[model samples]
Target: MDIVVAITLFVLALLIGVEVIGKVPATLHTPLMSGANSIHGIVIVGVVIVAAHATSPLAWVFIFLAAVLGTMNVVGGYVVTDRMLEMFKSDKSKKGEGK
Candidate 1:
C-alpha cells in the first residue's frame, strides 16, 4: 500500500514536472531551477536518516546510492547555475559595449 501510494505520487510529480511547468520563459527557468536545486539539497538529510537506520544489505546498498546521488545533485546543480550566471554576465558585457 505504501509502495503503491509512493509510486503514484512519484508519477504524478514527474508528469507535472516534465509537462506542466516546462513552458515557462528561459529567464524564469534559471531562478526556478536554482530554487528547486536548493530543495534537492534536503536529500542529504534523507540520506543520513536512511544510513543511520539501515540494517539489511539491501538497505545499505540503497543508502549508498542515495548518498552518491545526493552528492551529484549538490555538485551538478552548482555547476549548472554557475554556467547560467556566466551567460548573463557575457550578455552584460555585450550591452556595455553598445552603450
Candidate 2:
C-alpha cells in the first residue's frame, strides 16, 4: 500500500476511535477499557509478527517498544477494571471485624 493511503487510513481510524470513545458513558468505561485491552493484546501479537520480518536495528527497536507499550496498556487496563469492581463490593470483612 502507498504511504499516503496508509497514513490517510490511520488518521481516519484515529478520528473515528476518538469520536466513538468520547461518547461512551462513564458507567461503561470499565468494560470499554477491558475490550481495548483485548485489542491491544492483538496489537502485541501483530508486533511479534512484525518483529519476525524486521531487517534493521530501527525496526527491531520499534517492535520492542510496541510490545512494551502494549503490555503496559493491557496491565493498566486490568488494574483500572479491578479498582472499579472493588468499588462495587460490600465491606463485609470490615463489618465482621467490627463485631
Candidate 3:
C-alpha cells in the first residue's frame, strides 16, 4: 500500500467522477444527487468508525473534517431533492386552480 499508488488511484477516481457527473442531464441531476447522498450517509458512518480508532492529532483532525463535510453533503443533497420535488407540486391558491 504505497502512498504513490494510493494517490494515483485517488486522482483517477476524481477524474472519472467529474467526467461522469459532467455528462449527466440536468433533468436527472436531482435523482443522481439523492442517490449520492445516501452513499454519503454510509461515508459518515465510516468516518465515525475511523474516529473511534484515531490516536494522532492529525488523524483526529481529518476524521472531524470528514464527519462535518459528509454531514453537510447529505443535508445539502436532501435540500436540493426537496426543492426539486416542490417544483412538481401544484399551487392551491392559483387563480382558477382548486376553485
Query: Largest TM-score belongs to which candidate?
Result: 1
Best by lDDT: 1
Candidate 3, residues 2-84, lDDT tens digits: the string is 99999999999889878877677686677777866755676788888898899999998999899888888777777877766
lDDT of 2 by residue, 1-99 (tens): 699999999999999888877677786677777767756666777887898899999998999899898877777777876766665343555676783
TM-score of each: 0.61, 0.53, 0.55
Better of 2 and 3 by TM-score: 3
What 10-residue stretch in candidate 2 is worst by lDDT? 84-93
Clashes found in each candidate (C-alpha, N, C closer than 3 A): 0, 0, 0
Q: Give the local distance difference test score of model 1.
A: 0.81
* lDDT, candidate 1, 26-52, per-residue tens: 776776678579567779888997788
Q: Rate the local accuracy (lDDT) of all candidates.
A: 0.81, 0.77, 0.77
RMSD of 1: 4.6
Question: Quick one: ranking by TM-score, best first?
Answer: 1, 3, 2
The window of 10 residues in a row where model 1 has the poorest summed lDDT is 19-28
Better of 1 and 2 by TM-score: 1
* Total colliding residue pairs, candidate 2: 0
After superposing candidate 1 on the true structure, give the runs of residues whose Cα lies further than 4 Å from its correct spot: 1-26
- With a 3 Å backbone cut-off (N, CA, C), the pairs that clash in candidate 3 are none
